[model samples]
Structures are given as C-alpha cells and as structure tokens.
Target: MSGVLEKIGQTQDKWFVFLDKLESRMHEICTAAVPEIREVFEQDRDPYKRAHGHLLMGLRGQINQMRSKANEVREEKIFQFIDGITSELPGHGFFTGSHDRLYTFRIACINRHNLFEEKIAFYMSLLNNAAGEQDLEAAYQEQLQAFEAIRDQFSCKQCAGQMTIPDLFFIATYVTCPFCQTQNTFIPSTGAQMVLHQARSLAEQRTAHLLKTYEESKPKNSLLYRQYLRSMFDEWNKIVPDMAEENEKFYQRLLQDHLNSINHY
Candidate 1:
C-alpha cells in the first residue's frame, strides 16, 4: 500500500488505543461511583428516596459526560481517519474500484460507535450492580410475609363480620365479608404497594427462559416471540388482573406490528 493509505490504516489502528484509554477512564469512574451509590442506597431512609435518586442522577451525569466525550472523539478522530481513507479516492484499496467510499466510511463509523456503546453499557451495569446489592429484596419479602400472617386480622366494617383477605394485595382492594355479604376496603403497606410496581419484572423473571429461547431463535420467529410474550403477560395479569385488558391490547398491538413488518417486507 501507498504511504498515504498506510497512514490512514495506522490512524484507524489508533482507534483501539483511543478506546482503551476511554474504557480505562470509565473503569476508574465506575470504581469510585459504584461504592458511593451503594452506600447511599444502603443508607436510604426517606420513603421518597431522594438520596438514591440524587446519587443515581450523579452517576448518570458522569456516564453522559463520558458518552459525550466519546462521541466528540469519534466525530473528530474516527471520522478524520475515515476521511483520510476517502481522500485517496478511487485507488486506495482493493474495493476502491467499486466506488463505495460512503459505505466504507459508514462501516468504520459504525464499528467505532458500537465500541463506544459497549463501554457505555459496561459503565452503566456497574451502577446497576451496586443497586442490586441492596437489601430491598429481603425487605419486600419480609413485608409480604408479615402481611400474610396478619391477613386474617382484618374484618368487615359494616357488620363487624369476618373478612378474609385471601391473597397478597398490593393496593387497596375490596374484600367481601363471608357472613355479612358486605365489601370492605383493605389497604396494604407501602412496601406491599411496591410489589404492584414489581409485578411485571417478577413475571418477566419467571418467564425469562422462554423469552431467552424466543430471542435466540434465528430468522426472528414471531410465533416464538409471541408465545414468550403471551406467557409473560399471563404471569403479569395473574399478578395484576386489573391491568389485564390494557396489557392484552398492548400485546395484540405488538403482535400486529410484528406481523405487519413481516408483510410489509
């Protein structure tokens, strides 16, 4: 290859060095941020979780700064490297005869951008790991068990009749008194209400194996994906029956969109 083309290749090679430096710096930031976020989360006392929110926002801000800097480097350096390759015009490489300079530039840009994205994900995962180490899961479970033990303690307000709150309810639900035939409002604790928000996540975890199979299937089988979605939604609806209609509509729309995309092709 000509000296100019070789220089362009070497410039492309330097992208690895740039990425290595960026990743090393991201590691340092995450090393400091992760433990700090975990400490704040562990010390969290407010029901509003303002401290946790602030800490998370601070970590996200650092991530955003890193992303922005990486983007600037890609725009200034990676593109400059590709432009060097493009500068040699129609004779720089074997594929030069095809006049695919734009495609070449696109491929190089995508490669570097993908590298940056992977690093961004790695840094973000560190924050997520820190949060996951919290005792919230144990708290949620303990609160749930306590509610279960005292579920029989509630009664009908109207007739002073026995009321059985047969299931674990996240929100205030109407419990029918067996003897008086009156509906009584049963309110759960704040921690129990958190289960309402966690329903979808719990359902997803239960059906993750099916979802994984659907995701790993080649040719992107809509049937497999739909099966996984149906199972997941079934579990979600079981957890929150009030949202079944809304969730079913969402499921149908997604299925329709998937089918439509296949047809449109």
Candidate 2:
C-alpha cells in the first residue's frame, strides 16, 4: 500500500512538472506572437491586408501546433495515468483515501488545462479585435470628397475641350469629347483609385454590427453569418453597383467555403 502511494505521488509530481514546462513554453510563444501579429497587421503593403492575413495565418498555425502538443500530452500522459489508476482502484482494498486524492488531483488538472485554453482564446480574441479596428468608412469618404473636388477639372486631351466627369471612375476610362468627337483617356488620381480598393472595407464597416452579433453567438450560428454576408454585400453593391455580379459570385464562393468548413457530408 505504501509502495503504491509512493508511485502515485511520483506520478503526480511529474504531471505538475510537465504542466509547468508547458505553461512556460506557452508563455514564450504567446509573448513572441503579439508583436509579430501587430507588426504584420500594421505594416502590410496591401491596402486590403491580404499580406497581413497570409503572414498571420502562419503564426496561427504555429499557435495551433503548440495547442495540439499540449492536448496530446494531457491525453497521453495525464488522462491515461488517471484512467489506469481508476481501473485498479476497484481491485485494491487499501486505495480508499488514495482514490479520493487521485480524483481530486484529476479535477485540478482538468481545471488547470481549461484555464490555459481560456488564456489562449482571450489572446486570440484580442488580436482579432485589433485587426478589425480600422475606420475604413472615413477613408472611403475622404477619397470620395477628393474625387468630387476634381471631377469637373478634366479637359479633353485631343481637342482641349472642357469636359465634365459625370461619374466616378477608379481607373483610366475613355471619355468622348463632344466638340471634336475624339476619345480621351481620363486618368484618376491615386487617391480616387483607393476608393475602389477600399469599397468592400467600407461596406464591412457599415454592416459590422451584424457580424458582431454572429461572432458573439455560441456554436457560431452559420445562419447568422449568412445574414451578415447578405447585408454586407448589399452595402457593397450600394457602394459599387457595377460590381454586383462579381460580388455575388464571390459571395457564393464564400458560402461554399463555409459549407465545406462545417459540413462533413
């Protein structure tokens, strides 16, 4: 009986030591990840943050690998030991007090593991919030006002006839001169072009509340996500109605992706 107790004590000590090492490793990874995530997000060359997403995905993969390792260790080393001890408890006459102690230890380990998982989740949420905090609506409005200020300043290149740009064009477009019947390429300034690039972001900003509700729901209701997507695309089309067909295709593709992610069959 004393020998069994000694072995159990040793196993418990090893479990705690393993958890301590894991905690230290988790801390190191999380501490290193925060600055890298922020730097990637802030310094991304792509206005749409595509480069940031790609780099951050790699970092998320590393974090997932660390989590997988911890889960594997808990299952293989901790749970297996507890299960083995539990199976032997019924056969041992001297395991009454020891059994209670082992059960208490198991509960403590489970709670500790859960706490670690919560910390990881909280860190991930902080990073996500930071990424989504950009005020894209303000940028869109700034670009729109800049375009409006310069809309009437264009003149035909072929005939030097004063021409009014009737609509907002993101790229160079052929404008017909009424005086000479000549074609002139109207080129937008850099700021005007940025409006097209940020159109979707502005729409997202407009419909972010719906997305927030979807995100806050437990089990992540896909129906709520679909509603948010529809609303967001509606806002997108309102911004750039010419791209509605293309946006609809993109929306369908995203729905298919969501289906693939959640449905096994």
Task: Point to the candidate with the largest lDDT.
Answer: 2
Prediction 2 global C-alpha lDDT: 0.78
Residue 182 local lDDT, model 2: 90
- TM-score, structure 2 vs. true: 0.67
Pairs in steric clash, model 2: none
Candidate 2 residue 263 C-alpha distance from true site, Å: 18
In Å, residue 54's CA in model 1 sits off its true spot by 4.2
Q: TM-scores, in order shown?
A: 0.64, 0.67
Clashing pairs in 1: none
**Stretches of candidate 2 above 4 Å error?**
24-40, 43-45, 83-102, 171-173, 185-194, 210-234, 241-265
